[model samples]
Target: MDRVEKQAALFNLPETIVPHSVLALGYPAEENKEPRESRYEENRVHFEKW
Candidate 1:
């Protein structure tokens, strides 16, 4: 097994505990902007119409 796999086994962790690239596929590449700000703006606009 590889080094990471060996360490995980030694620590009694499941094989699925490693980070998955798919989890980050949807994040923007730009680091200077906050994604949550846009989401909060959208929610605010939607609630204001009700």
Candidate 2:
């Protein structure tokens, strides 16, 4: 996060661009893990869409 200039240069990106966050994606190391559950309310989810 501190070295913005170096990061951009390393990836050959333009200096004008700025990165706000980093996302690391990968699958779980173990298989058959139970998924966590969450309650879904129509009003909480849809907001003004409905």
C-alpha TM-scores of all predictions:
0.30, 0.42
Separate clash counts for every candidate: 0, 0
In terms of lDDT, model 1 sits at 0.47
Q: Distance (Å) between predicted and true CA of 22, model 1? A: 23
lDDT digits (tens) for residues 3-40 of candidate 2: 77665555565566674554575778788568768575
- lDDT digits (tens) for residues 1-50 of candidate 1: 47667655555556567522212236556786544544345543322122
Top-lDDT structure, candidate number: 2
Compared with the true structure, all predictions reach lDDT values of 0.47, 0.58
